[model samples]
Target: MRPAAPEDEPALDAFFGHVDAEDLRFRFLSAVRKVDHDQLKAMVTIDHDRTEHFLAFDPASGQIIATAMLAADQSFRRAEVAIAVHRDFKRMGISWTLLDHVAEFARWKGILTLESIESRDNHDAIDLERERGWIASACPGDPTSTILRMTL
Candidate 1:
Protein backbone atom coordinates (compact mmCIF):
# COMPACT_ATOMS: atom_id res chain seq x y z
CA MET A 1 0.00 0.00 0.00
CA ARG A 2 1.13 3.54 -0.77
CA PRO A 3 -0.13 7.08 -0.47
CA ALA A 4 -2.75 7.96 -3.06
CA ALA A 5 -2.06 10.55 -5.73
CA PRO A 6 -4.14 12.73 -8.04
CA GLU A 7 -3.52 10.28 -10.87
CA ASP A 8 -5.18 7.54 -8.88
CA GLU A 9 -8.65 9.08 -9.13
CA PRO A 10 -9.82 6.93 -12.02
CA ALA A 11 -8.58 3.72 -10.46
CA LEU A 12 -10.14 4.69 -7.13
CA ASP A 13 -13.48 5.33 -8.83
CA ALA A 14 -13.32 2.00 -10.57
CA PHE A 15 -12.43 0.30 -7.31
CA PHE A 16 -15.44 1.85 -5.57
CA GLY A 17 -17.66 0.99 -8.52
CA HIS A 18 -16.84 -2.68 -8.09
CA VAL A 19 -17.35 -2.61 -4.32
CA ASP A 20 -20.54 -4.04 -2.85
CA ALA A 21 -23.31 -1.61 -1.85
CA GLU A 22 -23.18 -2.74 1.75
CA ASP A 23 -19.44 -2.21 1.84
CA LEU A 24 -19.81 1.26 0.43
CA ARG A 25 -22.42 2.09 3.02
CA PHE A 26 -20.09 0.81 5.72
CA ARG A 27 -17.23 2.87 4.38
CA PHE A 28 -19.20 6.05 3.96
CA LEU A 29 -21.66 5.52 6.81
CA SER A 30 -24.53 6.21 4.42
CA ALA A 31 -26.56 4.62 1.69
CA VAL A 32 -24.53 5.64 -1.31
CA ARG A 33 -25.37 3.93 -4.55
CA LYS A 34 -22.39 5.35 -6.37
CA VAL A 35 -19.29 7.34 -5.59
CA ASP A 36 -19.33 10.43 -7.75
CA HIS A 37 -16.27 11.73 -9.60
CA ASP A 38 -16.06 14.83 -7.44
CA GLN A 39 -16.06 12.77 -4.27
CA LEU A 40 -13.45 10.44 -5.73
CA LYS A 41 -11.33 13.43 -6.62
CA ALA A 42 -11.55 14.79 -3.12
CA MET A 43 -10.35 11.46 -1.76
CA VAL A 44 -7.35 11.11 -4.01
CA THR A 45 -6.26 14.72 -3.84
CA ILE A 46 -4.64 14.65 -0.42
CA ASP A 47 -2.73 17.39 1.39
CA HIS A 48 -0.46 14.80 3.10
CA ASP A 49 -0.08 17.05 6.10
CA ARG A 50 -3.62 16.83 7.40
CA THR A 51 -5.53 14.51 5.10
CA GLU A 52 -3.95 11.43 3.56
CA HIS A 53 -5.30 8.63 1.43
CA PHE A 54 -3.69 5.28 0.83
CA LEU A 55 -4.44 2.54 -1.67
CA ALA A 56 -3.52 -1.11 -1.59
CA PHE A 57 -2.87 -2.73 -4.93
CA ASP A 58 -3.41 -6.29 -6.08
CA PRO A 59 0.11 -7.46 -6.78
CA ALA A 60 -0.86 -9.67 -9.66
CA SER A 61 -3.57 -7.53 -11.27
CA GLY A 62 -2.07 -4.15 -10.35
CA GLN A 63 -5.55 -2.90 -9.53
CA ILE A 64 -6.54 -0.98 -6.45
CA ILE A 65 -8.01 -3.51 -4.05
CA ALA A 66 -8.32 -1.50 -0.86
CA THR A 67 -8.29 2.07 0.41
CA ALA A 68 -7.68 3.85 3.73
CA MET A 69 -8.27 7.49 4.52
CA LEU A 70 -7.13 9.65 7.47
CA ALA A 71 -8.47 13.14 8.06
CA ALA A 72 -7.13 15.15 10.99
CA ASP A 73 -9.11 17.77 12.83
CA GLN A 74 -8.15 21.45 12.67
CA SER A 75 -6.30 21.18 15.99
CA PHE A 76 -4.31 18.21 14.62
CA ARG A 77 -4.89 16.29 17.81
CA ARG A 78 -7.59 13.96 16.60
CA ALA A 79 -8.18 12.30 13.26
CA GLU A 80 -10.96 10.28 11.69
CA VAL A 81 -10.07 7.15 9.74
CA ALA A 82 -11.99 5.03 7.28
CA ILE A 83 -11.11 1.95 5.28
CA ALA A 84 -12.64 -0.36 2.71
CA VAL A 85 -11.45 -3.49 0.96
CA HIS A 86 -12.81 -5.04 -2.19
CA ARG A 87 -15.40 -7.75 -1.74
CA ASP A 88 -13.04 -10.36 -3.12
CA PHE A 89 -10.28 -9.14 -0.83
CA LYS A 90 -12.14 -9.55 2.44
CA ARG A 91 -10.78 -12.09 4.95
CA MET A 92 -7.28 -11.77 3.56
CA GLY A 93 -6.07 -9.54 6.45
CA ILE A 94 -5.98 -6.58 4.06
CA SER A 95 -8.21 -4.41 6.22
CA TRP A 96 -6.15 -5.16 9.28
CA THR A 97 -2.94 -4.25 7.51
CA LEU A 98 -4.43 -1.07 6.13
CA LEU A 99 -5.74 -0.05 9.51
CA ASP A 100 -2.30 -0.55 11.00
CA HIS A 101 -0.77 1.53 8.24
CA VAL A 102 -3.20 4.37 8.84
CA ALA A 103 -2.66 4.24 12.58
CA GLU A 104 1.08 4.47 12.11
CA PHE A 105 0.59 7.44 9.83
CA ALA A 106 -1.68 9.06 12.36
CA ARG A 107 0.91 8.67 15.09
CA TRP A 108 3.63 10.09 12.90
CA LYS A 109 1.44 13.10 12.17
CA GLY A 110 1.30 13.91 15.89
CA ILE A 111 -2.34 12.91 16.22
CA LEU A 112 -3.34 12.05 19.77
CA THR A 113 -6.35 10.00 18.79
CA LEU A 114 -7.64 8.06 15.82
CA GLU A 115 -11.32 7.42 15.45
CA SER A 116 -13.64 5.60 13.14
CA ILE A 117 -17.34 6.42 13.02
CA GLU A 118 -19.01 3.30 11.77
CA SER A 119 -22.60 2.30 11.24
CA ARG A 120 -24.15 0.11 13.89
CA ASP A 121 -24.91 -2.46 11.23
CA ASN A 122 -21.26 -2.82 10.28
CA HIS A 123 -20.48 -5.41 12.89
CA ASP A 124 -17.57 -6.92 11.02
CA ALA A 125 -15.70 -3.63 10.91
CA ILE A 126 -16.51 -2.80 14.50
CA ASP A 127 -15.30 -6.18 15.60
CA LEU A 128 -12.12 -5.77 13.67
CA GLU A 129 -11.50 -2.39 15.27
CA ARG A 130 -12.10 -3.88 18.68
CA GLU A 131 -9.66 -6.66 17.93
CA ARG A 132 -7.10 -4.00 17.17
CA GLY A 133 -7.58 -2.50 20.65
CA TRP A 134 -9.90 0.36 19.73
CA ILE A 135 -12.61 1.29 22.19
CA ALA A 136 -16.16 1.30 20.86
CA SER A 137 -18.95 3.52 22.12
CA ALA A 138 -22.43 4.49 20.92
CA CYS A 139 -22.45 7.72 19.02
CA PRO A 140 -24.21 10.34 21.16
CA GLY A 141 -26.77 11.62 18.68
CA ASP A 142 -26.81 8.78 16.20
CA PRO A 143 -28.16 5.56 17.54
CA THR A 144 -27.52 3.95 14.21
CA SER A 145 -23.80 4.47 14.49
CA THR A 146 -20.88 3.53 16.77
CA ILE A 147 -17.66 5.37 17.34
CA LEU A 148 -14.39 3.42 17.63
CA ARG A 149 -11.47 5.26 19.11
CA MET A 150 -7.77 4.57 19.81
CA THR A 151 -5.35 6.83 21.57
CA LEU A 152 -2.00 7.08 19.86
Candidate 2:
Protein backbone atom coordinates (compact mmCIF):
# COMPACT_ATOMS: atom_id res chain seq x y z
CA MET A 1 0.00 0.00 0.00
CA ARG A 2 1.12 3.55 -0.72
CA PRO A 3 -0.19 7.07 -0.46
CA ALA A 4 -1.90 8.14 -3.64
CA ALA A 5 0.07 10.57 -5.77
CA PRO A 6 -1.23 12.95 -8.43
CA GLU A 7 0.06 10.71 -11.21
CA ASP A 8 -1.86 7.81 -9.70
CA GLU A 9 -5.19 9.29 -10.78
CA PRO A 10 -5.42 7.16 -13.88
CA ALA A 11 -4.80 3.97 -12.00
CA LEU A 12 -7.21 4.99 -9.26
CA ASP A 13 -9.91 5.80 -11.74
CA ALA A 14 -9.40 2.49 -13.47
CA PHE A 15 -9.47 0.73 -10.13
CA PHE A 16 -12.89 2.13 -9.40
CA GLY A 17 -14.13 0.64 -12.63
CA HIS A 18 -13.92 -2.79 -11.06
CA VAL A 19 -15.87 -1.71 -7.95
CA ASP A 20 -19.38 -3.00 -8.19
CA ALA A 21 -22.31 -0.57 -8.15
CA GLU A 22 -23.40 -1.32 -4.60
CA ASP A 23 -19.88 -0.96 -3.31
CA LEU A 24 -19.63 2.41 -5.02
CA ARG A 25 -22.75 3.50 -3.22
CA PHE A 26 -21.31 2.35 0.09
CA ARG A 27 -18.03 4.11 -0.58
CA PHE A 28 -19.52 7.41 -1.61
CA LEU A 29 -22.64 7.18 0.56
CA SER A 30 -24.77 7.84 -2.47
CA ALA A 31 -25.99 6.29 -5.67
CA VAL A 32 -23.23 7.40 -7.97
CA ARG A 33 -23.25 5.75 -11.37
CA LYS A 34 -19.57 6.45 -11.85
CA VAL A 35 -16.88 8.06 -9.77
CA ASP A 36 -16.23 11.35 -11.56
CA HIS A 37 -12.86 12.84 -12.49
CA ASP A 38 -13.33 15.65 -10.00
CA GLN A 39 -13.73 13.13 -7.18
CA LEU A 40 -10.67 11.25 -8.38
CA LYS A 41 -8.74 14.50 -8.48
CA ALA A 42 -9.78 15.33 -4.94
CA MET A 43 -8.68 11.88 -3.79
CA VAL A 44 -5.22 12.16 -5.33
CA THR A 45 -4.62 15.83 -4.58
CA ILE A 46 -5.07 16.23 -0.85
CA ASP A 47 -3.33 18.05 1.97
CA HIS A 48 -1.24 15.47 3.79
CA ASP A 49 -1.93 17.09 7.18
CA ARG A 50 -5.67 16.71 6.89
CA THR A 51 -6.30 13.87 4.51
CA GLU A 52 -4.80 10.67 3.20
CA HIS A 53 -5.73 8.35 0.38
CA PHE A 54 -4.00 5.02 0.07
CA LEU A 55 -3.88 2.59 -2.79
CA ALA A 56 -3.34 -1.15 -2.52
CA PHE A 57 -1.98 -3.05 -5.49
CA ASP A 58 -2.11 -6.61 -6.66
CA PRO A 59 1.36 -8.07 -6.30
CA ALA A 60 1.18 -10.19 -9.42
CA SER A 61 -0.73 -7.93 -11.87
CA GLY A 62 0.40 -4.67 -10.30
CA GLN A 63 -3.13 -3.31 -10.63
CA ILE A 64 -4.79 -1.25 -7.90
CA ILE A 65 -7.28 -3.45 -6.07
CA ALA A 66 -8.36 -1.28 -3.17
CA THR A 67 -8.28 2.21 -1.69
CA ALA A 68 -8.60 3.55 1.84
CA MET A 69 -9.17 7.23 2.59
CA LEU A 70 -9.02 9.16 5.86
CA ALA A 71 -10.12 12.76 6.26
CA ALA A 72 -9.67 14.71 9.45
CA ASP A 73 -11.51 17.60 10.97
CA GLN A 74 -10.02 21.06 11.44
CA SER A 75 -8.43 20.23 14.77
CA PHE A 76 -7.12 16.86 13.56
CA ARG A 77 -8.54 15.21 16.66
CA ARG A 78 -10.92 13.00 14.69
CA ALA A 79 -11.18 11.52 11.25
CA GLU A 80 -13.59 9.63 9.04
CA VAL A 81 -12.38 6.68 6.99
CA ALA A 82 -13.81 5.10 3.91
CA ILE A 83 -12.61 2.09 1.95
CA ALA A 84 -13.47 0.38 -1.28
CA VAL A 85 -12.20 -2.81 -2.90
CA HIS A 86 -12.53 -4.15 -6.38
CA ARG A 87 -15.21 -6.81 -6.84
CA ASP A 88 -12.63 -9.37 -7.93
CA PHE A 89 -10.73 -8.90 -4.69
CA LYS A 90 -13.49 -9.41 -2.14
CA ARG A 91 -13.20 -12.14 0.56
CA MET A 92 -9.40 -11.74 0.51
CA GLY A 93 -9.28 -9.75 3.79
CA ILE A 94 -8.18 -6.59 1.99
CA SER A 95 -10.72 -4.32 3.69
CA TRP A 96 -9.95 -5.65 7.13
CA THR A 97 -6.25 -5.16 6.53
CA LEU A 98 -6.68 -1.68 5.16
CA LEU A 99 -8.91 -0.63 8.04
CA ASP A 100 -6.30 -1.71 10.53
CA HIS A 101 -3.56 0.00 8.57
CA VAL A 102 -5.48 3.23 8.32
CA ALA A 103 -6.37 3.20 11.98
CA GLU A 104 -2.73 2.71 12.90
CA PHE A 105 -1.73 5.53 10.59
CA ALA A 106 -4.36 7.77 12.15
CA ARG A 107 -3.20 6.96 15.64
CA TRP A 108 0.35 7.72 14.66
CA LYS A 109 -0.79 11.09 13.37
CA GLY A 110 -2.47 11.88 16.73
CA ILE A 111 -6.03 11.40 15.71
CA LEU A 112 -8.07 10.53 18.78
CA THR A 113 -11.23 9.32 17.12
CA LEU A 114 -12.05 7.46 13.94
CA GLU A 115 -15.42 7.04 12.36
CA SER A 116 -17.25 5.91 9.24
CA ILE A 117 -20.70 6.74 7.95
CA GLU A 118 -22.27 3.68 6.40
CA SER A 119 -25.55 2.83 4.83
CA ARG A 120 -27.68 0.50 6.89
CA ASP A 121 -28.14 -1.74 3.90
CA ASN A 122 -24.41 -2.36 3.63
CA HIS A 123 -24.36 -5.28 6.02
CA ASP A 124 -20.87 -6.58 5.30
CA ALA A 125 -19.17 -3.26 5.94
CA ILE A 126 -21.25 -2.54 9.02
CA ASP A 127 -20.43 -5.97 10.42
CA LEU A 128 -16.75 -5.54 9.71
CA GLU A 129 -16.65 -2.16 11.44
CA ARG A 130 -18.41 -3.61 14.48
CA GLU A 131 -16.10 -6.62 14.57
CA ARG A 132 -13.16 -4.24 14.51
CA GLY A 133 -14.45 -2.55 17.70
CA TRP A 134 -16.22 0.44 16.22
CA ILE A 135 -19.43 1.38 17.97
CA ALA A 136 -22.43 1.95 15.73
CA SER A 137 -25.19 4.48 16.22
CA ALA A 138 -27.99 5.83 14.09
CA CYS A 139 -26.98 8.75 11.95
CA PRO A 140 -28.93 11.77 13.07
CA GLY A 141 -31.60 12.93 10.64
CA ASP A 142 -30.68 10.05 8.37
CA PRO A 143 -32.33 6.87 9.40
CA THR A 144 -31.14 5.07 6.31
CA SER A 145 -27.54 5.20 7.49
CA THR A 146 -25.46 4.25 10.53
CA ILE A 147 -22.42 5.87 12.00
CA LEU A 148 -19.53 3.73 13.26
CA ARG A 149 -17.16 5.40 15.67
CA MET A 150 -14.17 4.39 17.76
CA THR A 151 -11.98 6.22 20.21
CA LEU A 152 -8.36 5.59 19.38
Best by TM-score: 2
Q: CA lDDT of each candidate?
A: 0.92, 0.96
Q: Model 1, 39-85: lDDT tens per residue?
A: 99899876888999999999999999999999999999999999988
Q: In candidate 2, what are the lDDT values of residues 1-152, reduced to their tens digit? A: 99999999999989999999999999998999898999999999999999999999999999999999999999999999999999999999999999999999999999999999999999999999999999999999999999999999
RMSD of each: 0.7, 0.5
What overall lDDT, based on C-alpha atoms, would model 1 receive against the true structure? 0.92
In model 2, the Cα lDDT at residue 65 comes to: 98
Give the range of the ten consecutive residues with the poorest summed lDDT in model 1. 41-50
What is the TM-score of each predicted model, taking all chains together?
0.97, 0.99
